[model samples]
Target: MTWTSYGATCSAPSAGYSASTFASAVQLLAAAQCFSEESLPDSSDQNFAAYDFIIVGAGASGCVLANRLSEIEHWNVLLIEAGGDPPVESSIPGYHFSLHNSDFNWRYKTVNDGRTNQGNQDGCIYWPRGKMVGGSTNINAMMYVQGNSEDYQRWFDAGNTEWTVEDVRRCFRKSENYQDQLLDQDPDIRNHYGHDGPLVINTFNSTERVRGNKLISAYDEIGIKKVKDINVANAFGAAIMTVTASNGERNSMSKAYLVPIKDRKNFSIMKNALVTKVLINDLNQAYGVLVEQNGVTVTIHANIEVILSAGALNTPQILMLSGIGPKEHLESKGIQTIVDLPMVGQNLIDHLLFPITVFSDELTENSEADDEFDNLKYFHNRSGPLAQNVVLDTFAFYATNEDAKYPEFEAYVLRKRKNSSGLKKEFVTLFRFTDHVADSIVELNQNHTLHLFLLSLLHPLSSGTITLSSNNPKDPPLINANYFADDNDLELMVSGIQKLLELLDTEYFKSIGGFLGRTRTPNCDELELGSREYWKCQCLDIVSTVFHPVKTCKMGQLESDSVVSSRLKVHGVENLRVVDGSVMPNHISGNTMAPCVMVAERAAELIKEDYNLY
Candidate 1:
């Protein structure tokens, strides 16, 4: 075919395009086909045939299970996702923020509790969950953090004997394929991670390396010393984050684990299928699922097991719908109760985020044409501003005291270019900030470069709940994220904000004329800026989730206190299991994607042992 026809075949514009534009379009089309479309397996037609395993929600954990369980040639593995395949934007690291509120996102908003997050729109924070095959992995910033080893120790100490620190470490390594060049220079760091695994982990090919290094030095000036690798150092200090991307593209769990085994004869995937309820019999055993797809409802049976990886919110919703939740709540909704697990939707926990904005004159905003050229650069060479998650790839973990081993707070720096026009929309849409709040941020960015220190309270004393809004499976669950319900959480957050404010006085920040930007809020108008009370007020008004929700289906020994056992099997229910972020009994010190992979890795081994597959 001629060059023009070849470009047309790849969906490039045939006319009214510059030569560079045509070439870039063709390159992007080829990359999408090679990296995503061609590697993804075709969705299976809805079938009533019984399978050995039925996995719900093709999310991070679910994708891992699909690959591991399907490794057995005799087992028929069916993985179902509510959304279709990830769009081309998901494969591009720079487009991560664009996935929010899109078709691939569940776009769930927390039920407004008048007590918290009042500054947000409708007094509620938006909770974005992935609906597609890779789930949140496709949409997340792609940081690969394993959290502190002590986080797993807390789980083991909480009667979860199967999740010891050593076991958790091994499982984390098992799923990791450490591809960062730092491994070649440092033996200790090399030994810290797995070299041969499905998930590719490397440092982002960031264009802002110079600024990142300067930021690291600034963090060091404020007592959070720079570390060689955050994972090797157990997240004790600041570092350029290791991420789950390689060669300028996002390596989502679907691409890392599922794509390699797409041709397996025993594996099957059902896309755009929403699982309404688990099919349970009178004997308290799950047999199948009730799925809604393409305006049709059907029952798909599982001969051996039914696994729920539908995430923190949906897993609990599905259990309650299946009559396996609290007796009072189920009966109130006119659903018969089979097993009264009172903690089914209780003890909801998440890392709460509060943004602290600062401004400087050193950074320059990219123009619209510059952004377009960035896209062209990425398409041509896979190296540009689009090659990384921008400033989100640099982070720091710190504790209140210098002697502490684990961090109480985590911070991610996001740079908003000076005079940028999208800052208001990002604040309003991505963060669901109110118009007043969004406008205040945009007004500041109009004059100077905005440096947002997105601070996360790693662990909180306050917890919330996820409950049924109605008996209807189609109805979204009520997410009562009671952030800062406890007074201690607010106090700690104030301290964390003070810690990050120290950056303003650092040499690196001072050299760039950095200064804290006062966020205009009605409640804090009278309070002195930078005061303890001012920070406290901001904590309550600006608090939202870092998108890590867990513990709705907590894992523990008692049926009264938790929903699943250490093996991840649902308590009081046979042939059913929950393997997702919801199974976390407590909050970890960092982002949750990597830990969820570890949970699935260990859960897979336990399943193999139970079934004698090894």
Candidate 2:
């Protein structure tokens, strides 16, 4: 019986549950096969009772690290993820949008600062982190971007020898697979990229090429020539984007690394086993993690070490809970302070993106997926528009701010709205005036609106911090994303919108005849271009985050000011290492996924090299 029937069976007559509910009574049975958690090694599997190394939070870092460290075939490695398992649909590329706002996402919201001059009074924005086994890697927009050279070199300049630009390039090379579409355009790009790597990075294959051309033209107008590949080093203008997909499907770390080595006798996974705290003994070294499963608290000791890959949000929380944060803060919360590291939860950074929406009366997303004939094709051939991501398309990189010489904002053009393809026939005829379909305007075609993602990169300048709300490990870490605290972040986004407006005035855009000014939107009318304050307010109202949170637990020699050291060991603490985004000393100017994977690789090497595990 299933959980539905079990729930019904447990209800009393007064509660309205009847005898008819007996059909699906699995919940009443209390069987171990309940689908709450992903399948892992059975508790009764005494053969896998303990491991030499146990990593927590099977995200981008944990999954990659687990697969790599467990490859030794002799040493046992157990990876634990608390988000449980994903529904079957989540594993498929077609159901990507459906997974959002559902169980698969972390669904974290912002702290809601009242400083915003406009918009909702709640002052919070919905921030979703991947809660499933693969973490955010499973749920991100799939943009594959390596950080800028200056970003990495800044780390070395700040005393992180392990994070020199060359070292980072080597790490990216180990896990990167350059796209054919990008390299094919320019053969000189062949040696520029590293193809034979673990991570599958390829360009999104689509039915139409309008978005790509638009991005290319936008960059040309801005005087930034498109580069062969951003990951190849120099990144300046909008070019075709490469995604982390394998054959038009998402290549999550679980699939790329973990599952392939699942059957390795020494490797084990404990899904739904929430590790509450890191157990440190008198030596102040991490001995093991304390986990709670099925109302039972079980302590699993790792003789060698414990790596915390819980990500930026939870990693710092875990450290503080394990008595490894600032002394005063921990003591006030009634938890014994193991190490006084003030910066454990400070210096949190994220990319805030403002959606610049414009109406297109000529073209809309080609959603042939809605047709009955297309349904047959998808069910049988697995081809056509359904196989492609509607949100995937061309991207533009350029400077939107006066002070910024490099690209400060990015635009991702889409022919189809995310998950909105099959719902309406409006997308196709929406842009009726554009070049591609203008000749067929008598057919009542509508153009598509541009979803301009004004991403904050290059120099965010402003930073935030993460702190523990309580000593309880169960409470979520308090996240205060001080977004838009920097003046440049606001100025740059306004410049980006103005740039888009400039694109509108071009003959090409004028020919289409659908201008953002005629839309009669409230905010657009209120926006005054001459004043910085007005533009800044507009930026705050329109801008949102790109879900790239990093540097919560920075690494540095200053133990009091840093969360972890260059070795990723928690400053002032022994045998405890942070192998996730938390170890970054500062924010990178790109998506954190690829960088996190690189960090995991470097972390594994650091652990192995330091411990001499090999």
Candidate 3:
């Protein structure tokens, strides 16, 4: 048996003569200046190689880490991504419809779509990961909400001391820049929010379709209470949504973390340079990576460290490819096993969300009218849905009993009004009144599609893994999400689903006509509350993913059934660490984006402290 070698950089990356694969590489890496390929400059120069640190998959944590580490005067950083940059449509506030099926979408389908696939209402579920530069954040809904204190405390209890609420809180504070006055009266909220940071945070301004005030008022009427700003340390009630945007344009982690420093002399980024595997020496220490570029293979050694920030899905994939995962799985792919770590890709978790579709003819009629339009008007004037968060228009975090264990309730309002009916259903006109008045210029032609995105950990007790499909670099790893395997998880979600019906029954649905239209994916006309059987049938039929995938590479101090220590260093491997959602010991209480960003901030500090960066 012989180990073939070919690389435009140093040793093994074949300069294939295959015209077809070369064209594919050429098509992928045409613009090689801003972000060059991890391979080489061209056919002539195939030996120019190496970097101080090679970070793969420019996602949330990867981008931030690249930016922070490369900032050092003498450090050399090489950031490689398998994808391209986002398109113009992804930047449009109203272009969310285009994001799902476009080029930016990785569009990885599930292997077990039949068992737990609410996202793919139609036969198969499509796990749309961003294959572009900024990764998923470029295409995500962009609602920025941090996990609560208890969420991180759970990590602390799980033996991750560095992940305690206070430890993680510092990271959360790094990305915040609050501009809310109500926070002045509330010390708890004020203490949590930071006044200085790279990202911007502000309340949703007033608009015709949706206003922050109107939402706060409505949620308040139901005893949910009004929050000055939910991003603060304590998130109790409804507050304006935080976003990853600046001046209406989405602020992707790539732009916020990397593009600004593109001109830095020591910094180099290779777009379309998919890392095939991390190169480990005889001592089992990671030293570099093998990347396939425009029809060429290349080796780029990391003189200092090899950091894996490929995100939840791809991070574990790369580790497995490098033979640093479960020994048996790699052997099946005909690859030599390095360190056998059982937890490399286990503990996968994600939110399976269900939208309670409803129609609103009277706008604020559910004790509310056809109020969904208020958001468009809000966005139009930079105040309504456009200014405020589409997810936080209204929400709740509640426990069913006096001594409940975890929060089992979370509901967000969405005013689809007239927008959701175009493909098949007939749209109705928007007629309303009150705090939000439709702008005369923005004459109301229709109603809104109001639905609540809810998910209470359907597979909380269940664990999953990420294994290699083949040794091929282009292939995505097998994602066994282990969704809905626990009965306790079902109990919590069912309770929330039942409560949602009650909210609808309270004149909320009747005021707007009482019948929330059905999804085209699968329609359920016979929804009755008297029986759990009927409810489960609809839930299994209609619910989909909220797109928050976490815990692929769990971290803990105990080191049992864990991939990395609480510090995020890979077990038994020196100069190698996994940073990103993959390191999350447990899922956060809310959106995973904010928490992922917080992870980058804290991890950067830890890296600096360990290296004594001043």
Maximum-lDDT candidate: 1
Better of 2 and 3 by lDDT: 2
TM-score-wise, the better of 1 and 3 is 1
In candidate 2 the C-alpha lDDT for residue 56 amounts to 89
lDDT (Cα, 0-100) at 381 in candidate 3: 39
Q: Alpha carbon lDDT of residue 109, candidate 1? A: 94
Q: lDDT, candidate 1, residue 597?
A: 95
Residue 374 in model 1: lDDT = 65
The candidates, ranked best first by lDDT, are 1, 2, 3
TM-score of 3: 0.80
Candidate lDDT scores, in order, read 0.86, 0.65, 0.63
Model 3: how far is 131 from its true place, Å?
A: 2.0
Better of 1 and 3 by lDDT: 1
Determine the backbone clash count of candidate 1: 0
**Higher-scoring candidate on lDDT, 1 or 2:** 1
Q: Candidate 2 clash total?
A: 25
Tens-digit lDDT track of model 2 for 1-614: 22333233211111111122331231122221221223334332443355789898989999888988886667788888877655444433444554555666666666756664134224455567777778877667677777677778888999988777887888787877665764656766676567777777786555445656665675566565666566563555667666786444567777677756767877778776778899998878888989887677888888777889989898888888888887788888898987777787888888776544444454443443343244234333444443455554556666654555345656664433333322222222221112222222212223444443344554577788788788877776777888778886676666666775666665556555545522211243455543555556655643456778888888887886787789888766667788998888877666788889999888877777785764
- Candidate 2 regions exceeding 4 Å error are 1-49, 179-187, 365-382, 390-392, 400-406, 414-454, 517-532
